[model samples]
Target: MKDMITHIYKGLECFLLECSAALVRRRALGGWRSDPRQLREQRRDEFRARKVAE
Candidate 1:
């Protein structure tokens, strides 16, 4: 039971880290955007590229 809990916690931590990284990338790209649509597209492209690279 203890080991299962530890594994679950670790998975959650990794998920949170990924979310934070995506948010950071979104914010950074957002700073350069003047249009909401462009920002959304930019984030989507960035996320795709990162996933492909990974």
Candidate 2:
């Protein structure tokens, strides 16, 4: 019983840590972009595409 409780506790701790990491990453990027540079390039491309489309 104690062992089972310890295992569950450890699992919860790991899940919490993963959740924290995801939150940090989301806050850091401000969205779902994987990298800051990638996000910038994506925006630039999008602007160019819009200009071309018009």
lDDT of all predictions: 0.72, 0.69
lDDT of 2: 0.69
List CA RMSD, all candidates.
Answer: 4.8, 15.5
Clashes of each: 0, 0
lDDT of 1 by residue, 1-48 (tens): 999999899778767866786577667766545566766687677667
Best by lDDT: 1
Location of the lowest summed lDDT over 10 successive residues in candidate 2? 42-51
Candidate 2, pairs of clashing residues:
none
List the candidate 2 regions with Cα displacement exceeding 4 Å.
32-54
* Tens digit per residue, CA lDDT, model 2, 1-54: 999999899778766865665667667777675786765575567556755975
